[model samples]
Target chain A: SQTIHQWPATLVQPVGSPLSLECTVEGTSNPNLYWYRQAAGRGLQLLFYSVGIGQISSEVPQNLSASRPQDRQFILSSKKLLLSDSGFYLCAWSRGGRAEAFFGQGTRLTVV
Target chain B: QKEVEQDPGPLSVPEGAIVSLNCTYSNSAFQYFMWYRQYSRKGPELLMYTYSSGNKEDGRFTAQVDKSSKYISLFIRDSQPSDSATYLCAAPSSSGSARQLTFGSGTQLTVLP
Candidate 1:
């Protein structure tokens, strides 16, 4: 069975601080990885996706970036966080050519 | 118009009542349709997935897709308090460039005891 693991279930960071969120998947190879943010009273927005190692596609241009260091390890980072960056972050993985993706527990970040 | 439109209703219904949640899309190229349930602060969980048009049922949940009308529905039979959550409708991106899934705003359902 395939499973996704994400860290820092909840985070509280000050403005202009650096941020790092990690996601790792097991039981799959060359899987598609995605990062999504869900704002209050809004739909989940796609932030970044990776097709393979060292390849990242960003949907929304913001203060955040994603990197695929390994086949199953994905990282979302930000040099300086903004107040608007506060939201629930989710990590998901799917097989190539598949539409359904599995999600991780998610990280709730609050910027003050 | 947004690609997918769903009513963000804090719909409150009595237990055992049948709940109907719906979403409409403007994209005809969307070939895959799915329903996901998200608890208060947890990640969304896949509830149902369907392709093309027709109905697919699992246990007490039934998913219906009408491609001609560009509408999809999720029906919950004998709803319970455990079913209280947000239901979101999703489909793969039609743009072919990225495999990201587009989502509806989501409908919040509350099953009252």
Candidate 2:
């Protein structure tokens, strides 16, 4: 079975501070990875998605960026955090084409 | 207008009652549809998935997709308190290349014991 692991399940970062959230998938290779920010009543907004290593697509322009360093390792980062950047961040993986996506536990980030 | 739309409902129901959740989309090109459940402060969990139209059932959950109407629905029979959560409907990107998904605002359901 495949499992996704996200670190720092909860984080409290101050404004203008750097942010780094990691997500790694085990038991799957070359999977499509995605980063989404979920806000209350706004649904899950796709921030970035990667089909392969070193390839990332931004769905919404903001203060966040994503990277795929390895086949199953994805990272979401920001040089400086903003108050609006606070939300429930989720990491998901799917097969190459269209398929059911599996999500991680998520990281609750609060930018003060 | 948004590609997908769902009622942001905080619906309350009694235990053992039937629960119905719904979503509507404006994009006809969307071919795949899905439903996800999310607990407080957690990630959305894929509950049911259907392609195109028709109905698909899994245990106590039934998923219905009406391509003609561009609407999808999820029904939960014999609902329990454990089933209380936010339900989100998702559709595939029209482009189909990235397999991206556009999600609904989600409906919050609470089953009282």
Candidate 3:
């Protein structure tokens, strides 16, 4: 079975501090990975997605960037965080163009 | 207009009652429809996936897609308190590797015991 793992399940960061969130998948290779953020009472917003290593497509312009260092390892990072960057971040993986997506436990970021 | 729209309902229902969650989309190019459930502060879990138009059932859950109307629905029979969560609707376009998913503003459901 395929599973996704995300670290620092909860994070509290000071404004303008650097941020890093990691996601890794097991039991699958070459799967597409995605980064999404959900604000309170809002829909899931697509931040970035990667098809392969070193390839990332960003949907929204922000202070954050994503990288695929390995076939199953994806990282979301920011040099300086903003108050607006606080939200629940999710990592998801899918096979090819499939509609079914498997998500990790998610990271709750609180920027104060 | 947004590509996908869903009512963000804090809908409260009694246990054992039937629950209906819905979403509508304006994009006709979307070929894949899915329903996801998310607990508080957790990630959304895929519950149902359907292609084109028709109905698919899995256990107590039934997913219905009407492409002609660009509407989708998820029905939960014999609902339980454990089913309390937010339901999100997602659709992927036919563009393949682009594989972007458009999401609806989820509806929060609570099954009162």
Candidate 4:
């Protein structure tokens, strides 16, 4: 069985501060990884996705970025946080060229 | 217009009632459809997915897709309080060689006990 791990579960940061969220997958290799931000009544917004290491495609242009350092390790980062950058962030993985996605427990980020 | 759209229903129903959720997409090129369930303050969990224009059932849940109309539906039978959550439908769009998912604004359902 494959499992995705993301941390920290919750975070409270001041404005203009840097942000770093890590996600990792176990029991699978070369999986497709994605970062999504879900707002209340706004739906899940795809921020970034990576098909392989060192390759990242950003869907939405904002204050966030994603990186695939290893085959199963993905990281979401922000140089400076904005008040609008607060939401429930989710990390998900899927098989290459497939649509069935498995999500990790999300991180609730609050930028005050 | 958005590629995919869903009714944002804060629907309330009694336990053991039948529940239905639906979504519509604007793209006919979307070959795959998926449904996800999200609890309050949690990540959305994949519940069902299909590529063809038919119905697929798993236990108490059924997923229906109509490629001709670009419509997707999910039915939950014998609904319980645990079934209370937001249901979202998605379709994948081509992005380079990879694919990025586009999701609908979820429909919130509460099954009271």
Candidate 5:
């Protein structure tokens, strides 16, 4: 079975500070990875997706960026956090094509 | 208009009742549909997936998709309090990486004991 791990499970970052969130998938290789943010009372917003190492496609333009440093490791980063960046961040993985996605426990990021 | 639309219902239902959740999409090119359930403050969990226009059942959950109408639905039978959560509908676009899913604003469902 495949499992995705994201951390820290909860984060409290001060305004203008830098941010870094990591996601790693075990038991799967060359999986499609995605980063999504869910605002309070809103739907999941796709931020970035990676097909392979060093390949990242950003869906939404914001204060965040993503990187696939390794086949199973994805990272979401921000040079400067904004108050609007507060949300529930999720990391998901799929085998490619129309396969069902599996998600991690998610990280609750509160940018104060 | 958004590609996918879903009612943001804080729908309340009693235990053992049948529950229905729905979403409508504006894009006709969407071919694959899926339903996801998210617990409060948790990641969305894939519940059911359907391709094109048809119905698929898994245990207590039923997923229906109508490509001609661009509508999709999820039904939960014998609902329990543990089933309470937000439901999100997703459809894959026709463009690159058809696996990329476009999501609808989720509907929150609560099953009372």
Candidate 6:
């Protein structure tokens, strides 16, 4: 069975601070990875997605960026965070032409 | 306007009652539709998905898609308190480079015990 691991479960960062969220998938290779943010009362917004290693596609230009360093490892990062950047961040993956994605336990980040 | 739209209902229903959730899409880029269930603090879990138009059932849940009308529906039979969660309808967009799933605002359902 394939599983996704993401961390830290919760984060509180000061304004202008850096952010890094990591996610890894086991039991799959060359899987498409995605990063999403869910604000209160809002749906999951796609931030970034990767088709393969070193290939990242961003949905909307924002303060965040994603990278696929390894086949199953994805990283979401920001050089400087904003107050509006606070939300529930999720990591998901799908492969073999499956449209439905499997999501990971999200990280609740609060920018104070 | 959002590509996919949901009621975002905080609907409350008695246990064993039937529950319905719906969403509407407006464009052709969305080829597949899916329903996901999210607890209060966890990530959304894929409940079911349908590529074409029709109904698919699993245990206590049924998913229906009508491409001609661009409508998606999920029905729960004999609902339990464990079924209380936010139900979100989503579809993949082919217009953008990401080609990832676009979601609706989600309907929060609570099956009261």
Best by lDDT: 1
TM-score of each: 0.98, 0.97, 0.97, 0.97, 0.96, 0.96
Model 6: per-residue Cα lDDT over B1-113, one tens digit each:
88999998889999999999999999876778889999999999999988778999999999999889989999999999999999999998653433578899999999999
Instruction: Enumerate the candidates' DockQ scores in order.
Output: 0.66, 0.76, 0.77, 0.76, 0.66, 0.63
Candidate topping DockQ: 3
Itemize residue pairs with steric clashes in candidate 5. none
Model 1 segments beyond 4 Å from truth? B94-98
Q: lDDT for every model?
A: 0.94, 0.92, 0.92, 0.92, 0.89, 0.92
Instruction: Please report how far candidate 1 places residue B97 from its true position, in Å.
Output: 7.4
Q: Which stretches of candidate 3 lie over 4 Å from their true place?
A: B94-96
Candidate 4 lDDT, tens digit per residue, B1-113? 99999999999999999999999999988988899999988888999888879999999999999888889999999999999999999998877666778899999999999
> What clash pairs does model 1 have?
none
Candidate 5, which CAPRI tier? medium
Which residue pairs show backbone clashes in model 3? none
RMSD of each: 1.1, 1.1, 1.0, 1.0, 1.2, 1.4
Model 5, B1-113: lDDT tens digits are 89999999889999999998999999888878889999987888998888888889999999999888888999999999999999999987634663678889999999999
Candidate 6's displacement at residue A28, Å, is 0.3
Give, for candidate 2 chain B, the lowest lDDT window spanning 10 residues.
B92-101
Tens digit of per-residue lDDT, candidate 3, span A44-71: 8989998899999988999999999999
TM-score for chain A in each prediction = 0.98, 0.98, 0.98, 0.98, 0.97, 0.98
Clashing pairs in 2: none
Superposed by TM-score, candidate 5 places the C-alpha of residue A8 at a distance from the truth, in angstroms, of 0.7
lDDT of candidate 1 over B60-93, digit per residue (tens): 9999999999999999999999999999999997
Error of 5 at A91 (Å): 0.8
CAPRI quality of model 3: medium
